[model samples]
Target: MSETADTLFSHVKPEQTGYVSGGLRDFFLYRDLGVAAATQGKVIAHLVKANMAPEKGTGWHRHEAEFQIVIMLKGWARFMYDDQETLVEAGDCVHQRPGIKHFLFDYSPDMEYLEIVSPADFKTIDVEPVCPIPDPTPWN
Candidate 1:
């Protein structure tokens, strides 16, 4: 009897995968690969890794037809709304409703997080840039 290919299994190595950085330590995994959503019965969501500096963060933004779930993987950050603010740390999570005015502020040097969204093709919605990237060296 001969062994069939279906019985073969291999381990995946992390180093075999590649990562890309956007700006000043902000990196994104799967920035190049596009997963097929229709096959999975849902849209593909990408993982974003932000190792931001103090006072570094995303500008106020929203999505027209998608909801966002933000989970703090490490360090601390502040989530700001139009009239309120919430401080979140590792293991904390927040869900932003579609069309809400909000922003994230990284108050620590080692802040990291994950953002999961539905209909993953969604992009920023009429966002007005408020927080500009500060000088990288003085962030420490």
Candidate 2:
């Protein structure tokens, strides 16, 4: 690695990962959202920003190895778990344990959220996408 390799804000293109879905068209994952400490071989922490339009969001999914904390940065969203739903808006945060089934719903046009995962290699977890919820609105 170069001298600045660990300090630079590297750009991660969306196409680099084969993980894509028709339901999350506006979402993208930035692997290098911030700089990592040289002492930590794995990222100490990382950010995942999801930009969603009205009624666009991620499908139900679970991570096997990574626990995640999500914070809504803009607009509004609904966090759906197996038996409960919580409305999360700007400044709201939610913690999701690893291996639990969960999903996010962006009901506004400018919905954006940040997912901070610790021990950043936690992202290597396998994400299994489940069936999406049907939209009540026509033409979705």
lDDT of each residue in 60-83, candidate 2, tens digit only: 666544556777777666666754
| Clash count, predicted structure 1 | 0
Report the CA-based lDDT of candidate 1 relative to the real structure.
0.55
Each candidate's TM vs. the true structure? 0.62, 0.56
The TM-score measured for candidate 1 stands at 0.62
Per-residue lDDT for 25 in model 1? 32
lDDT of 2: 0.54
* Candidate 1 lDDT trough over 10 residues, lowest sum: 27-36
Q: Residue by residue across 52-86, what tens digits does model 1's lDDT show?
A: 35344566777754666877777666666654677
